[model samples]
Target: MDTIIIEGGSTRLKGQVTIEGAKNAVLPLLAATILPQEGKTLLRNVPILSDVFTMNNVVKGLNIALEFNQEKKEILVDATGDILDEAPYEYVSQMRASIVVLGPILARQGHAKVSMPGGCSIGSRPIDLHLKGLELMGAKISQVGGDITATAKKLKGANIYMDFPSVGATQNLMMAATLADGVTVIENAAREPEIVDLAVLLNKMGADVKGAGTETLIITGVERLHGAEHDVVQDRIEAGTFMIAAAMTSGDVLIKDAIWEHNRPLLAKLTEMGVEATEEADGIRIKSDLTKLKPVTVKTLPHPGFPTDMQAQFTALMAVVNGESTMIETVFENRFQHLEEMRRMGLHSEILRDTAIIHGGQDLQGAPVMSTDLRASAALILTGMVAKGQTKVTKLNHLDRGYYQFHEKLKALGAKIERVSEVEHV
Candidate 1:
C-alpha cells in the first residue's frame, strides 16, 4: 500500500500548476470511440489516471483496437473492426464509468451486455436512468445473473426525460442517440462542461447534437459516424481542488489554462471566503492573504450551480475558517463520510442528515487517515497540508482515480508532501 505523508502547518504554497484533461469528459470520449464505424479517432490532452486506464481496458476488451501514447497524452482508437457486444465483469467491474460503453456497443451491434459497474463508495449511483432512457429508444433491457443487457434490432429516437440531471445518464443516452433513427431529445439533461465536450466530439464525428450545456439535448441520428480528432476539456474538478488548496493555505498559485466560466461557482464561493481569484489571459490565479477565512454556507447542485464534486474539499476549508460554516450535500447521501474522518484530525462538525454544520477555527493535528472516496482523498490531503505535524493518508488507490501527480504538483508548489510505500516509510 502507498501513503502520502504531509508536513502541515504554515506552509505557503506559491507557484503555477498546469492541470490535465477532464477525467469525466475523457471517459465518455473513450467510450464514444466505439460510435465511429471507420477510421481512427484521436483524443488529445487525455489525462493519464487510473480510471482512464480502467476505461481504456474496458474499451480494448470489447475487441476495439486502441493505442495510448502517454508521452503525448493522446489516445488513438480504431473501433472499425469487429466489436464485441459483451463487456465482461473483469474490466467493467473495476470502474463505474465503464457503464458508458454500454450505449455505444448497443448502437453499433444492436446489443450490449455489460456487468454491473463498481466505483467509489460515496453513494449508490444507480444506472436505472441509463436503462430507462435506452428503453425509451426501443431497447429491451434485462438482467441476467450479474450482467445487464440491452438489445434492439434498430434503435429509434424517442423523447426521454431525466428525473435528475445525472451526467452519466446524459452521456450514455446522448452517445446512444448518435446512430439512432430520427431525432432524440433529452429533457432535464446534464449541463456540465464535460457534457458539452462530449457533444462537441459527437458533432465532429458527424452527429447532430445540440443544446449541450443546457437543460435539453437534441441528437439527430446519422447513417454512420467516421473518426475525428478532438481535444479534451480542462478538468474543472482538479482545477477547483488546486484553487481550494491555494485558498486554504493563504497561498498564491496560478492554474494554467483553467477556464473561468466552468469554475464560476467555486470561484464565487472562494470570493465569499475572502479569497481573491483573478481571471488572467493564460489561466486563473488564486491569491489569498487572509489569516482566517470567512465561513460561508455551501449547497451542492447541478451545473450553473455549486457542484457536488467540490463539496468535500470545501468542507475541509470550512473546518478551519473564521466562523461556523454549513455544508449541505444534496447530491450523494453518504458523502459526509469524510467529515467523520476529519473528526479524527481535530475537526468539529455536526452532521444532521444530509447537512453538516462545521465549527471553524479549530486547531487540527495531523494523524493517520483513510480516504473515503476519490475526492475525499484529495480533501484529506488538503486538510493535512494545513494541520500540525505529519499526516499520513492511506488508500491512495482512490486518489489515483481522479487527480494526476497530485503530490508532485503540490510539492512543486512548496507543499511538504511525499508519496511512499508502507515498507519504505517504515
Candidate 2:
C-alpha cells in the first residue's frame, strides 16, 4: 500500500503544465490494434499510466507482440499472426477496460472468451448493452465460471439500438461491426471524442465507418484491416483536473497539449463561475483570484456535454466556494463515494439521490482520507490542496492507475506533496 501526504501552501501557484494523451481514447484504440494485418500498428503520444500498462498486459496475454518505448512514449503492437482469443479473469478483474478485447478478438478470430468484469468506484456498469448488441450482430454469448464465451460462425450486420449511450458498449460494437457480413447501423450511440478517435484509426485501417461522433453510426463490412499509425488526443479529464487545482489554489496555470474543443463545456462553466480562462491555439490558461468562487450547478451527460469523470474534481472545487453548488451525476449512480471522505476533511455536503448539494465557504482542515476509485483519488488530492493543514490520502494505487506523475506534477506547481510506502501487516 502507498499513501500521499500533502502540506498546505498558502501561496498561489503560477506555472505551466503539459497534459498527456487521452487514457479513454488510448485504451480502446489499443484494443482495436488486434485487427491489424500487416506491419506494426504504432501509437504515439501515449500516456504513462497504470491503466495503459494493464491494457498492454491484456494485449500481451493474447500473444500479440508489443514494443513500448517509455522515453519516446510510443507503443508498437504487432497482431499480424494468430493470437489467443481468451482474456482471463486475472487481467480483466483489474480494470474494466479489459473487456474491450472481446470486440477485436471476436472480429478477428470469430470467437472470444473473456472474464466477467469486476466492480469499480462508480455504479454498476453492466455489459448487458454490449452483449445485447453483439447478439444482434449474430454472436452467441454465454457465461460459465465467470467467463463470457462469444462465438459466431459468421457475423452479419443488423440494425442495433442501444438502450443507453454507453461509451464502452458503443466502441465494442463498432469494432465488432467492422468485420460483419453487411452494413451495420448503431442508433443512439455514444458521441465521445474518444469514439471519434477510434473511428479515425479504423478508417485509416480500411474500415468504412461514417457518422462516428454522432448519434447514428454506419459501418460497411470490409475484407480485412491493415496496420496504421495514430496519435492519441489530449486527456480532457487531466486538463480539467489541473484547472480545478488552479482554482482551488487561487493560482494561474497554463495547460499545454489540451484540446479546447473537447473541453468547451467545462471551460464555459469555469468562466461562468468567474474563473479567468483563455483559450489559445496551443492550450488553455486558467487564473483564479483569491476571492471566493461563485457556486454553479453541473450535470454529467454524454460527450459534447459535461463528462462524469470530472464530477468528483469539480465537487472538490465546490467545497471552498462562496455559495451552494449542486452536482448531478447522471451517468453513474454511486459516484458520490468521495463525498463522505470529503466530509471528513471538514467540508459540508449532502447527497440527495444522485445529486450532491455542497455548502461551501468552510475552512477545511486536513484529515486522513481513503480513496475509493480513480477519480475520487484525484478529488481527495484536490481537497488536500486547499485544506488548512497536512492531509494524508491512502489507496494511492487507484490514483496511479489513471494520472501520470500526479504528485510530481503538483510539486512542479509548488505543491508540498510526497509519496511514502506503507508497511505491510503480517
Candidate 3:
C-alpha cells in the first residue's frame, strides 16, 4: 500500500502553486472528441492524471486514436470513426467520468453500450439524470446486468428540465444535444465553470450552444463538427484546497493561475474567518495571521454557491479553528467518510445525516489514517499538517486519480510530506 507521511505540529505552506488544467473539464472535453469526424481535436493544458489515462483508454476502445504528449501537457485525439458504441467494463470501471462518453458515442454511432462506471466511493451517484436527459433527446435507454445501452436513430432536440443541477448530467446532455436535430433547451442546468468550458469547446467544434454558466442552456443541432483547438480551464477545486490550507496554517501563499471569480464563495468564507486573500497578477494571494480563528457555518450548494468539492477540505480547515462550525453537505451523502479518518488525527466532530458539527481549537495527536476518496485524501493530508507528531495516510490510489504530483507541490511550499510505496513496521 502506498502511504503519504507527514511530520506535523508546526508547519506552514508558503509559496506559489501553479495549478494544472481541471480534471472535471478535461474529461468532458475528451468525450467531445466524438463530435468531430475530420482532423484531430487538439487539447492543451490537460492534466496528466490517472483518470485521464482511464478516459483515454475508454475512448481508444471505441476506435478513437489518441496520442498523449505528456511532455507538453497536450493530447491529440482522432475520433473520426465512432465505430464502436460499446464501452467495456475494464475501462469504464476505472473512472466514473467515463459515463460522459455515452452521450457523444450515442450521438455519433446512434448506439452505445457502456458498463456502469465505478470510481471513488464518495456516494451513490446515480446516472438516472443523465439517462433521463438523453431520453428526452431521443435516446432509447435500457439497462441489463449493470450494462446500460442507449440507442437513437437520429436524435431530435427537445425541451428538458433537470431535477438537480448535476454537472455530469449537464456535460453529457450538452454533448448529445450538439448533434440533435432541433433546438434543445436545458432548464435548471449546471452553472459550473466546467460546464461553460465544455460549451466553449462545443461551440468551437461547430455546436450552437448558449447560456453556459447559467441555469438555462440552449443548444441547436449542427450538421457536422470539425476539429478545433482548445485550452482546458484551471482547476478551481485545487486552488481552493491550497487557499484553505494556507489559511489554516497561518501562512502566506499565492495560488497562481487561479481565477478569483470562480471561487468567490470560498474566498468570502475565508475572509469572514479572518484570512486575507488579495487578487494579484493572474492569481490569488492568501495570508492568515497566527491567531485564534473565527468559526463560520457553511452549506454546500450548486455553482455561485459554495462548491461541494471544497467541502471536505473545508471541514479539515474547521477542525483547528477557534470555535464550533457546522457544515451541511447537500450534494453527496457519503462525503463525510473522511471525518472518520480525521478522528485518528484527533478531529472532533459529530455527524448527523448530511450535517457535521465540528469542535475546533484543540491540539490533535497524529495517528495512521486512511483516505476514502479523491478530495478526502487531500483533506486527510491537510489535517495531518496541523496534528502533533507524525501522521501516515494510506490508500492513496484515490489521490492519484485526480491530483497530479500533489505531494511534490506541497513539498515546494515547505510542508514535510512524502509519498512512499513501502511501510516499515516497528
* TM-scores of all candidate predictions against the true structure: 0.99, 0.97, 0.98
Per-residue lDDT of 1-426 in model 3, one digit per residue for the tens? 788999988989898999999999999999998779877899999999999999989888888799999999999988876468898689999888999999998998899999999998879999999999999887899999999999999899989999999999999999999998999999999999999999999999999999999999999998889899999999999999999889888889999999999999999999988899999987999999747579999999999899999999999889989789999999999999999989877788999999999998878888999988999999999988989999999888889888899999988998998888774522
Q: Per-residue lDDT for 63 in model 3?
A: 80
Candidate closest to the true structure, highest lDDT: 1
Total clashing pairs in model 2: 0
Better of 1 and 3 by lDDT: 1
lDDT of each structure?
Answer: 0.94, 0.89, 0.91
Q: Rank the candidates by lDDT, best first.
A: 1, 3, 2
lDDT (tens digit, per residue) of candidate 2 on 120-196? 65888889999999999999999998899999977889899999999999999999999889999999999999999
Better of 2 and 3 by TM-score: 3
lDDT by residue for model 1 (1-426), tens? 999999998778999999999999999999999999988999999999999999989889989999999999999999999989998688899889999999999998999999999998888999999999999999999999989999998899999999999999999999999999999999999999999999999999999999999999999999999999999999999999999999989999999999999999999999988999999999999999656568899999999899999999999888778788999988888898988888999999999998999998899999999999999999999999999999999999999999999999999999999999999988
Clashes per model (N, Cα, C within 3 A): 0, 0, 0
Worst 10 residues of 1 by lDDT: 288-297
Candidate 2 has what TM-score?
0.97
Q: Supply candidate 2's per-residue lDDT for 113.
A: 97
Q: Give stretches of model 2 more than 4 Å off.
A: 9-11, 290-292, 423-426
Write out the backbone clash pairs for model 3: none
